[model samples]
Target: MSDIGLFEAIYSTRSMRRLKPDPIPREVLDQIITAGVHAPSGSNFQNWGFVIVEAADDKRFIRDQYLKYYREMERLGSIPRMADIPPDRRRLFEAAIHLAEHMDEVPVIMLACTGTDFPTYADANNPRSITATLHASIYPAVQNILLAARALGVGATLTTLHYFFEEELKQRLHIPTDKEIAGLIPMGYPHGRFGPTTRGPASDVTHWGRWGEVGQEV
Candidate 1:
């Protein structure tokens, strides 16, 4: 709503793992939460909830949960299932293992959740209209937090692997089984310099109208 230099913010955000370990102040955490809750929701259902954790023990617990899942994936031979995946793809996932091992080193973690049950996904009266608006709503808030962090010299990345083992995560976090954990954002000051990123031009995916109904617009 502020139209506060969004292009720069969007272009600057990237997944940053290394952090400076300086704690995020409570006031800024409040602002990030406020920004996320302000995200558009379907019919004002306002189902988004964010849990912010900075305590050392809690952070370690979450990181261990990640390792539990990662080990399970490795045991199940999920890595080889990516036989079709290029080496670059494999490296990224392997990096996830490294991040999990180091997750506790970050200064803060924000968990974005929706107050909806898994069964609701199959419910005929499911608030598809409501939930659909949620990601769009919360993500901008996430972006706002990330950009604000960058501008403040903090580093962060929003990731979602925890949701893959939602049951274990719920048991560990004591969150009810109903809520949908959308993502986990880890934040802190950068331990190293932020690097330049590469991306394709917008024209590759942008369409003037009637998506993919190409060759008809200027």
Candidate 2:
């Protein structure tokens, strides 16, 4: 297969909420997991772990794990704060619930874990910059996985609601408690096709130096 550029990858990927019931091959899934390890890590610590769940029993458990949050939210009634968001975002959250409600049907689930928490080295409190940087490292890996899967005709959706019950998840999956669960991405073959996507122009958000300052040409 030909090499895929970053732009092509970005354009090719969508949330892919809907997926085929067919199973993903182990070898092909391995390639995606390996791709995640290539991502940059904070201070070159390289402490990330990618967990892929494909077994029906395991996927069902993971799906149940995802439902915990929505159930948690439902018990509390309405969203926790953030009412200021437009209707679209509220709907997006609901859509995520819809997806999670049926997550057992998705063929694969990937959990990105940090393996261990960052060590503190200062007074009462220093910036948790290292942890945030570690998070930044994982997203690129997730991006590559999504892109690679798209190129192979597999659909993927990166999710995070399960993070709400990280400890419970760790216990169920036997993941280390020290590890920070970054995100959960569910992937499988698409029942639909992918093509071009519409988005805001680069000029809309590109800033030269300052937040409000735009480049002369843009």
Candidate 3:
């Protein structure tokens, strides 16, 4: 929207955990949410709901909830040690730790949720398996939010660590029990710079007509 082309937005959108506390303008926030709403939904059910937290008290409440488990994980040695991860990704984990510590200072916390349980084809008795419909319905919108924020020069990252306390979040936010929390996005101006993402080359991961057939000629 800010003259950031579509592919430019896509390529530059990074998971920004180290974010400044500067408040996002209301107009920019609205545009990000609008971008999310415009995403495709299965059957056009449009069952998603979003809650944006900017109030100090609400941010504290959610941040405390997140830290509860985060601290527990730390005490239990569940968090990956810096020495364990490869050097290339060690910085990301470090930034995640920083975010956990300062989550209360985030200017905005966006919670993306589904307003209704997704219809499933699996038998009710053995419905422990996840269905594609559930993800297919909500994840596109989450991606749109990240891209839109990037285009607006806002930093955004999708996280589900808060999902561990989803029910508590619903009660605190007054979201009904029927709704499902898809993602929790932290938004603000980035303390770090945006850059192209690092990843395995597409050729290494792509398959042609068959599985386990990487780099097949077109």
Off by over 4 Å in 3: 75-78, 120-130
Q: Write the per-residue lDDT of candidate 3 for residues 1-218, one digit (tens) a residue.
A: 34788888888898999888999999999998999999998778888999998988888888888878887776677876666778988898888878877888999999999745555543565443334566677899999999989988899888888877998888988888878888989999998887698766788878887888898544
lDDT measured at residue 184 in model 2 versus the true structure, 0 to 100: 88
What's model 3's overall lDDT? 0.83
Output the TM-score of candidate 1. Answer: 0.76
TM-score of each: 0.76, 0.82, 0.90
Highest TM-score: give the candidate number: 3
Task: State the lDDT of candidate 2 residue by residue for 1-218, as single tens digits.
Answer: 56667788789787776777789998889887777777776666677788887788888877787787777776686554335557757755655666778798988888888745555423426457655666775777787788888777788888777767778778878897678788888888876676565677878788888898865566
Give the RMSD in angstroms, all C-alphas superposed, for model 3: 2.3
Q: Residue pairs in steric clash, candidate 1?
A: 20-189
Show model 2 residue runs off by greater than 4 Å. 1-5, 71-97, 119-124, 215-218
Clashing pairs in 3: none
What local lDDT does model 1 show for residue 6?
Answer: 59
Indicate the TM-score of model 3.
0.90
RMSD of every prediction: 4.4, 3.7, 2.3
